[model samples]
Target: MNLYSAVSKSPHRSGTCGPNYLQRLLRLDSPGTQTILSGPESKAMTHYLRSQHDVIIVGVGTAVADNPALNCRIEGVGLKGQPRPLIIDPSGRWEVESEKGLAECVRLAEEGVGKGPWVFTSLAAPKRNQKWSQALDKVGGAYISIPSSDIDGKKDLDWSKILEKLAQLGMSSVMIEGGGSVINTLLQEKYLHLIDSVMITIAPVWLGQGGVVISPPRRADASGQAIPAARLHQTKWQQFGDDVVMCGRIKQ
Candidate 1:
């Protein structure tokens, strides 16, 4: 696994430090003090997905919230082949409204190159104001529904079935980028084989508790111990302007 950080460039050099190190040192008031090296990380992720994953799986929240084009383009890093896009909208409803200049599903539909977009939803058609499903259909994307009855009295989601479906559609590997809840569900089910994260540190700003990028506590056992503890596979450090990027991989 390759980990990369997107940070700003600065004259001062700060190496690998804990989460609290930034707040204790720099001033938060400076407008352009924080540097984000979005180029390299974005390029790395795109390349990894294109090379390894046959499909890209994202939760509806990511689609509605980020509205990412989900294409392969590295702003400064360059461009490469694109991968197929898969959205998991179990209810066939898209909850977020599109805002101008914000990431949205519509934007992705418009700019998506190569394989276009494919949505997975349970609804056959739109009901009332829940028209996201219909919109997806209108865009010429395919939708898949997992029969609700398949989970009857089952504690675990039938990931085997999901994998089978993806396999049938020619998806060998899946890269899941997500909102917290989706990440939690996948982790809970022990379905995720790999995680690639770009950890960045910014000066001054630190919010104790708020929105988290990743969620679901590392699995724990009945003995109050963590089950299947995650082990670090690799770590890479690089300076992007003022910030440092830490890339790590977890052994499956």
Candidate 2:
């Protein structure tokens, strides 16, 4: 199965600016402040991509910050037809009580429109406090245990193991929407080989360097020649409202 990591960024390459920062940038009454980077057409494209994949995955940071429904809302696709929602929470820090995203998934299931989410956590996470257990019980939501690695003092999920498990569950394709860390990690040397393609939506606004951004890794060849961390091949671009979506395969 192939993995697709999608991200939306400002023209300056910033991925996200917190609510307060974004609010400060635009007129308070502007309806698009929160979603300044993703317009209607871009959103529809995202939903279309979700409908085409077997599962939609996001990091725990995104799950908490956006509290996204993560379900496909495109035309003609019913609840059951939506891709499964998955979150990578290696330490099991997700709080179902506060976050509405998972709850939204369950509500859809109650209406017979969709199923709940599957949270991928580390085996070391506290077994008794599986907070996702109760809500997920109502809609066939599950918890998957996978390996984790330490990246600069932070514990992150092992993409290789996660992919292997997804394949075992019969998932043919997965789409990754994220917090900046997840997108950047997938493009780094360690996990770059696992990604099949990347789709980035670029907005016209510039967020400058203070906002979140993609940081490519720097490395060198055997003879000490500088080499790019990663590269894209056969790139394609299309406009979606005020945004431009660039799609391409990761050069292997």
Candidate 3:
């Protein structure tokens, strides 16, 4: 699968990697819409990609909003060996006791063959959250401190930095399932070059709400207005259940 191929090339020069491939998948409504979007096909594709990738990443926003297990589940098929759940928790708010926190989720999934989640946070995390760290350890989940783009309380991160860290930790690839802003940064023109492939599952319905939008590639026109450039050049599309799956590669 190209999804696997893209991430397989995600390691570093100091380590082993087949090729440098960074891929992303998101579900969207129509085109240029920001809202909740997903269907049966998208669900199936999401599970498959999460299971296939070496690591699954969701920014803290998604972690808080969705509380996803990050495990592959397909009705009767069940989850195979699930990939590691990587949380971009710049604020250190994904505590074990935080209702839908990954720590608690892992504990609930402990009955199955699920592995603990891996939380990555900024160095500026509040010292008071030591108890949160303890809770993570209690559930087999671990928190790792990484570089941050911290400005006051507006903590952010460069995905490239985390990708480098993952490479060192023996993770050759990663799939980012997100909550908008994070994916927007990665897919922006400057960082877009880093991504190897793009896959999106589009549902037939529309949610006009400004929840979170999975943006497509864009470029500035002669008038300096950003316009929607073509998506992937070589893309394949398929209809599954109530949604359609689209896959394509980022042009080098």
Candidate 4:
């Protein structure tokens, strides 16, 4: 299975990191981004990427914050080409009954325009929230429960198990678009190798320190020497209107 992740971010002037404020900003009908960012082109690239992948995965945080449609909107790509939407909600915290995003997923599925979501939750989550499972079942969606493992004493989903589940569903490729923590966790030393490639869209504006940032987890050697920054091989950059898209594979 090939696992790929894509993100769009704006960096601060001081080289600090920030969130996808550009995306959020563009989502609003506010004045400001008209001349600076090419919103349509950037979004088209994202949808095109979605059309190319078999599944799209997002953490519950993103599923909440963005309320994304999670479907490929490119012209003429019918239901069969639509990537499967998957959410990694370890505790089944996502409220599918009220979440407009998953609601849209259900709508798309029923209308034959896209597929419903496949939510991954902890084994215990179903027992805790039978309503969540029931809601998914009502929409012909899946409520998959996998065992959780301890990471730093906190429960975390195992990516390997999740990938195996996706594989069982016949999905060969996955594209991860996210909220900060999910991206950061996958880039950590423990799971970094699972990623086959990464594509990032760099927006022109600086979002400063007040926003969420996507960064690889930092670690040190046994002697306390800091490890080098993560690197990508075959890195390539292309302009998507005002934003620059960088594509590369992990340098493992």
For residue 129, model 1's alpha carbon misses the true position, in angstroms, by 9.0
Candidate 2 residue-wise lDDT, 160-192, digit = tens: 777777777777777776655676777778877
lDDT of 4 by residue, 112-193 (tens): 7888788898877745456656666765678888778777788889876777767666677777776566777777788766
Clashing pairs in 4: none
Off by over 4 Å in 3: 1-37, 74-80, 99-104, 150-155, 215-230
Please tell me which model should have the higher lDDT, number 1 or number 2.
Answer: 2
TM-scores for every candidate against the unseen true structure: 0.57, 0.81, 0.75, 0.82
Can you give the lDDT of residue 193 in candidate 1?
A: 43
Per-residue lDDT of 100-207 in model 3, one digit per residue for the tens? Answer: 444535764465545567888777776536776676666566888888764335667765677777777778666765656666656566555566666666666654
- When 1 and 3 are scored with TM-score, the better candidate is 3
Question: Scored by Cα lDDT, where does model 3 land?
Answer: 0.57
The sequence of per-residue lDDT tens digits that candidate 1 reaches over residues 1-252 is: 122111122011111121212221222344213223234443453444444445555667556544555554534322224556667766655543344542344445545443546766653434423454455555445567644323324332234445556656655455554444445554443534423342333323344433333344566668888776444446676654444556555446
- Consecutive 10-residue window with the lowest summed lDDT within model 3: 13-22
RMSD of 4: 7.0
Model 2's number of clashes is 1
